[model samples]
Structure formats: C-alpha cells, structure tokens
Target: MGEQKVKTLAGDELKAIKEAGSGKKKSRKTTSGQIYISSSYNNTIITITDDKGNVLTWGSSGMVGFRGSKKSTPFAAQRTMEEMLKAMKGIGITEVDIFIKGIGTGRESAVRALNGSGIKVRMIQDRTPIPHGGVRKKKPRRV
Candidate 1:
C-alpha cells in the first residue's frame, strides 16, 4: 500500500485557526478595535470585535454570578464587561469604540465600569433608532 499523506497547518494557519476558535477578529488598516454592548430583557452580551468585525473577547451577563435574579442585575452586566476586558487585556487591547444598544440600566453601568477596568472607550455611539412616526393601520369602522 502507498504511504498516506496528511496536511499540516503553518504558523499563519495555526494563528488563524486559533483566532477563528477564539471568536475574535483582528483588523488590518487600523489597530484600534470596537466592542458591541447589548442588553436584552434577561441578559447582556458584549461582543469585542476589531475594526474588521471579528469578535475578540465576548461575554454574556446571564452566564455569571448566582443563578436567577442575580444574573439580571446591572452588576451582572459589569461582571460580563470584566470578563471581556480581562480577555482583551491578554490581546493588548487598550482602547475601543463602543456601540451600545437597548434601554436597560446595565447600559450605562457597563460603560462606566469599563473606565476603572483599564479599557479606554474612545467613543460611545447609540445605535438605537427612534421611530419618527406611528405605524400605519386601517381606520376602524363604526358599528
């Protein structure tokens, strides 16, 4: 029988594989990165993506602290940010462009907490759009 051949990953390939698995993306033209902060009714998610839209260090508020109500607090959001910043510190991420969504209390707390956590927030852009007008519907007929 002929010998079988196997493929191997080069250093670049290995790094790419690692980055892919890490869920974080790196930028090309710019060294600065961005972080996406979102809060839903029950949880908050922090997606740390570079300028290229690759998520670097991400965390969820629902996954930490005690189970139940504790997870829904603003503190949970802070903890989630802590985890994200800790991960970013490993990758030498010092500054981030923040994009915040939702009206949860956690929104402000999370950003404020980041100040003491060693991560510099260069900008905070609220992506929430306000509806300019009411929805269209047929007028009700009188009986």
Candidate 2:
C-alpha cells in the first residue's frame, strides 16, 4: 500500500476529461441596452442586454467557430460580430454603446461589421485605461 498509480491524459481519454469539465448552469437570465464586448488573451465575448441592462443575448469567439488559433484573427472577430448581430436582430436592438476592451484586430473589425449589419453604434470609447507611472529612473553607467 505504498506506491500509488499515476493517471495519464492523452487522445480520447484527454478529450473525455476536457468535455466532462465543460459547461455550467447559466445562472443568469437574459433580459432586453446592455452590450458588453471584451477580448482577453484567449477569447472574445459580446453580450447584449435588454432595456434594463439585463443580458438578452450573448456570443463568444468560441461559439462563432473562432476556436484556439482563430481567436486572434480579424475574420474570427468579424464572424463573432456578425453572429452576435444576427442574434440581436431577432430581439429588436437598433443601437448600441460599444464597449471595446482589447488591443486586438477584432476591436475595429467587429465594430465595422456590426455597422455594416445595420446596428448603429452611438459612441465608441477606448475603454482601455492607461495606468499612471510616477517617473523615469536614471540610467546606470555602461560597464
């Protein structure tokens, strides 16, 4: 009763492990003016809300087939926006306040695609805030 067996993850066993961990109960309700857009190091997410700012619909780069390598591409973001817009159209949203949060190519392309699809963006703000630095340090002598 000394040595314990080690588990290995590869191929289908790995896939099964991954799939088993996916999904959670959607704990929030979708309502009808809130549009939240964000892009992280891994994914891009767009959420639409009802008049009360409750999420009415939402989409992600993953949901639009922009998985893994596709997440950083402009085409991925464009597709994400298009699909998100289509979902929004079904719920009767005409205008939105775009909240962009990343420096990726998706930022601009996604907004342009939304416009081309007839969703008027009321305002565009660079939500990426720059933190303040105190001062520059003096350079040391080269040795």
Per-model TM-score, in order, reads 0.69, 0.66
Which prediction has the highest TM-score against the true structure?
Answer: 1
lDDT of 2 at 39: 68
lDDT per residue for candidate 2 within 23-128, as digits (tens), equals 7744443323556778666777888776567667788888887668788777787888888877777667777777788766677777778778766677777787
In order, the Cα lDDT scores of the candidates are: 0.78, 0.75
Model 2 scores a C-alpha lDDT of 0.75
Off by over 4 Å in 2: 1-32, 134-142
State which candidate has the highest lDDT: 1
Q: List candidate 1 stretches off by more than 4 Å.
A: 1-31, 136-143
lDDT of 1: 0.78
